[model samples]
Target: MLSFIVLCAALWVSFHLIAGYVAQRLPLDWLADLPIIGASYGWERGGRCYEWLGIRVWKDHLPEAGGLLRDGFSKRQLASAEPDYLDRFAHETSRAEFGHWLTWALALTFFLWTPWQMGVFMVVYGGLINVPFILIQRYNRARLRRFIARSARRSARAD
Candidate 1:
């Protein structure tokens, strides 16, 4: 049981790391306005939908993995308003969301060695852990995109 547990942990970590690496290399434009990742009606509406989830109360309690890699971008704080920074931050949110989704799918590997009941448990566990992070990324990305658009319109008017 111990070895099986270790294997599960390793698989989860490996999947997330690979997903993060791939996300970093992906073009920002590719993630931008991706219909699949695009904000839904509630998320687009100032991310108010998240308030119902008590997101503000527990979001910070999750382990912060943004800084795990040496060159990884940390989303803990918004340090700058520069276009490039905001753009990259926006891209990072999509990246994080993609990573969670991929990791959740990869959890299926747990079933290969474990029994069916255990597999179901692993999958459920994966969802329980990843869903909140996924929602956070989506909520943040929606807000950030809205802010960027407003800024763009303001600049256009000034010009």
Candidate 2:
């Protein structure tokens, strides 16, 4: 059991490293525009479950440069809210979220090597940690897109 846990940990690390590397190298424009996942679908509009996770409070604790597994390339800063920047950041964020989803899926595959009980435990554990991140990504993307839209409308009116 201990060995299994250690192996699973190693697998998690490797998946993150490899996935992040691939995501960075890929031309992610098409992937970023993937509508289904990119649409926050009102998840960020109001009393979101993410607020309960203290994401706003805790997010910055992570290194801005992420790590080998995640370059943290898409993080949005209020100070840099230019429309073009927000648009690009939102797409970058969507791409990162996709990478994270893949990481969770790839890691969960190894749980098959463990007993059923352990596998279930691993699945729950993975969700607990990754879900907040998923939520944060969706929330940020939604807001960014909205801001971009508003900016466009304003510019059109001005013209």
| Top candidate (TM-score) | 1
For residues 12-125, what per-residue lDDT tens digits would candidate 2 score against the true structure?
A: 778767766766766658767677655555655632646677877976665432333444464746558687677778787777777677666665675557667777776777
Per-residue lDDT for 1-159 in model 1, tens only? 899789778888798888777766776677665666654575347777887889888878887677777667888879999877987888888778877887888888877887899889989998998999988987787778778989999999999
Considering summed lDDT, which 10 consecutive residues are worst modelled in model 1?
Answer: 35-44
Off by over 4 Å in 1: 39-44
* lDDT scores in order: 0.80, 0.68
Clash pairs, candidate 2, are: none
Give the winner by lDDT. 1
Question: Which residue pairs come into collision in candidate 1?
Answer: none
